[model samples]
Target: MAALTGLLFLGAMGTANAADGFQTSVPSAILVDYDTGSILFEKDADKRIAPATLAKVMMADVVFAQLRAGKIALDTPLVVSVNAWRRGGGPSGGAAMFAEVNKPAPVGELLAGALVVSGNDAAITLAEGLGGTESQFAQMMNAQAQAIGMTNSEFHNATGFADAGQVSSARDLATLAAHIIRTFPDYYPIFAKPNIEWNRIKQRNRNVMLDAGIGADGLQVGWLKDVGYHALVSAVQNGQRLVVATLSARSEKERVEETRKLLEWGFQSFRQRQIFAADKEVGRAQVFGGAQSSVGLAARGPVNLLTPRSGGERVSARVVYTGPLRAPVTKGAEVGRLEISRGPVKVLDVPLVTTEDVAVGSLMDRAIDGGLTLMGDSVRDLARRAMAKLHK
Candidate 1:
C-alpha cells in the first residue's frame, strides 16, 4: 500500500514549472489565461486598492443582467435627473457624456457612451433608471460581486468617481472582465468602438490596445488622484485569449507599456500542455470493501497547463488521496487531487474524481477486506515507530 502511494506521488510530478521571470513597473497587476482561469503572472494581485473607472465594469454587469432578464430594453428611455447632471454630467468637471438636464436618452446610447468613452453621466443615468437611485444601484453592485465569487471587492458608486471605501483587486477586476466577455457577448463589442458621439461631443475609448492590431478587444480603463492609472486589456492570438489587469501605474503610457509587455511575454514564453482528456482515467485507487478491487480516477474536464515553450516536457505530477478509499463510491465523486509540478515549484492542482461507480462488497468480501485493512494499519504503525526510534 505504501509503495502504491509512492507511485501515485511520482506520477503526479510530471508537469512543467510555472516560473515568475517577468517584471513590471506597476505596483499591482495580474495576467490570466481566459479559457482555463490560470494565473500566468501576478504582482500584489489581491491587494485591495481603489478601482477608479474600472468600477464601471460592475455597473455595466448589473445593467447587462437586467437587460438579459427582460427587465429593461436597449431602447428604454431614461430621464436625466439633477443629481446625474451635477455629479456625472459636464458640471462636475470629470468624464461626462454631457447628458442634457431633464432630457430623455435611450439605454442603448447610454451604454455605448459609458462603455466606449467611460462617460460618468451615462453611468449615473443608467444606474438611477434601473435602481431608482444611485445608492440602491450600489447595493445591487455589491450583491452581484458577492454572487460572482469576487470575495475581496466592494462597490460604492456607479461611475467609480474616487469615493472612499470603494475598492477592488487586480485579480477581481480581471475576473469581472472575463465574466463580461463570457456572459454578455452581444454587448461586448461596444468596448471596441473607438469613440461615441453624444450631444455634439466625441469621446474616445481610453483603452488604446483595441487599436493595437494584436487581436485586442473591449475592456475598461480607470484612474484616480491617488490610484494613478489602471486598465484591463484582453486580446486573442491563435485562438488563445489573455486578460491583463494593471493598477497604480505612474501614467497611462506606463500602464499600456507594462500590460503590453506582460501579454507579449505570456504569448511568447508559454504553450499549453494537455495533461489528460476529459473523463479519461488518470490513475486508479484501491477500493476497500467494494465489489471492484480498484476504481479509476479522472478529471471532470480536460486538464491543460501553460508551460514554458522550451523544455516543458519535463513536468511531473502526483495523485494524492486519503486511502484506502472505502466504497460504495459514485461516479463523479471527488476522491483525490492531482498536483502538477516542475522541479520544486507547484504549478497546478485539480480534483481527481471517480470514473465509475464502485458497489459495496458482499459480506464475505467485506470481512476479508476488513482483516486486510487491519493488517495494513498495523504494518504502517510499526514502520512509523521504527522511523521515530531511528530519529531518536
Candidate 2:
C-alpha cells in the first residue's frame, strides 16, 4: 500500500511537469536553434500525427539534394507522365499544377510549382525526375530523413499535400528544415521565392512570415482537413537562425501568427554566444626543436553556446586534446575538444588541435641523449649496490 501510494504521487508530479512544459495551443509544436540544432521547446513532438502540406519539405529535400549532387540541373526537362498529372495536379484532381501529361517541364519550374504553388503535379514530376517514380522517390525521402537523424518520420508518398498515414512530428519537421538549410544552403534560396511565373501562371507565396518583420525565409506551409494546418518556418536575424513548426492549427492565419509569436518569444528569451572559434588558437604547446618553440590550438568552427538572455548565467569552456601530439604536426591538424558548460549543464563541446608541428631532433641529438642515458643508468646501478651493502 505504501509503495503504491508513493508511485501515485510520483505520477502526479510527472504529469504536472509535463503540463507546464507542453504547449497546448497546438496539437504538436517545436522550436529549435538552427545554428546549433538545439531543441529549445517541444510538445507532443513525436506523436506521429498527420504532416499535411508540410510533407513538401521532404520532397524539397529530395529535389535539392539531387540538384546539389549534380545528378540533375535546374533546366533538366522531366516528362509529365499520366500518373503524376492525375495524382499530383491541383485540388480537383490532386491540386494539379495543370501540367499536361506527355509534356516536358523544366525541373526548376516544377520545383517552383511544388514549393510556391504547392502543386501536386510539380511534386510528382520532380519525384519521377529524380527517383523514376513517385513511390521510389518517397523511399529516397525516407532514406534521407533517416540519414539526417529524423527518427520519428515516415514518407508514404512523394507529396505531403494529401494522403492517409503520411505523417511526421513537429520536432521532426523542425529538424528536417534545419538540416535542409545546413546541408543544401545553395538551393535553400528557392524556398524564399515570393512568386514564380511559369507558363504565364503566377502564384504568390502563402507564408506570411516571409514578409513579416522577423526576417523569416525558406520554409513550407501545409494544410488539409485531416491535418488542419501546419507549417515549418525559419528565420535568420543578426546571424542567428531558428526553425519552428506547429501542427493541428485551426486556420492558416492562426498558424502564421502563432509561429511568429513563438519565434519572437524564443529570439527574445535566448541568445547564441560564440564560446570558441574553430581553428582559432586557444593555447600553445611546447615543441622539441622546430623553428618555433610552441604550436597553437583551436577548434575547426565557432563553438556556439545558447543561453537564456537574462544574463549572469555561468558559461564555462574546456578543451580536450588528441593525446600528446607528435612533432611535425601541420598548421591545421585537429587535436582536441573544448567543453563548455553552464554550472552542471553542458552547453557546447568544441574540438581543439595543433596549429603547427614540432619536428623531432636530429641524429646527433639522439646519439648524445642515448650516451647520457646509458652513463646515468650505470651510475645509478652502482650507487644502488653500494647502498645495499651499507644496509646489509
Best candidate, lDDT: 1
What overall lDDT goes with each candidate model?
0.81, 0.70
| Lowest summed lDDT window (length 10), candidate 1 | 9-18
Q: Over the stretch 1-392, how does candidate 1's per-residue lDDT look in tens digits?
A: 44244233333323221243458989998887888766677778889999988888899999999999999999999999999999888899988888899999999899987878888889999999999899999999999998887888999999988778899999889888899999999988878888888889988887787876667888888889977999888999999999989899999899878888888888877777676899988888777878766788888999887766654335567777878788898988998888766566555667889999999976755665775666775553444445446757
What would the per-residue lDDT of candidate 2 be over residues 1-392, giving only the tens digit for each residue? Answer: 01000000101101111233434477778777877754556667777877877777898998888888898899999998887877776434555467778899998888878877778888888888888777888899899999987888888876775666677888788878988888888878888888877666677876677888997987887788866888789988788888988888888778887788778877876766565566666666433333333477777677665556554333445555443344566777765555554444333445566766666644543343334433643453354445446757
Please list the residue runs of candidate 2 whose C-alpha ends up more than 4 Å from where it truly belongs after superposition.
1-24, 90-94, 161-164, 274-302, 311-392
* TM accuracy, model 2: 0.69
- Residue 151, model 1, lDDT: 85
Off by over 4 Å in 1: 1-20, 283-297, 312-330, 333-353, 358-392
- How does model 1 fare in lDDT? 0.81
| Decoy 1 TM-score against native | 0.80
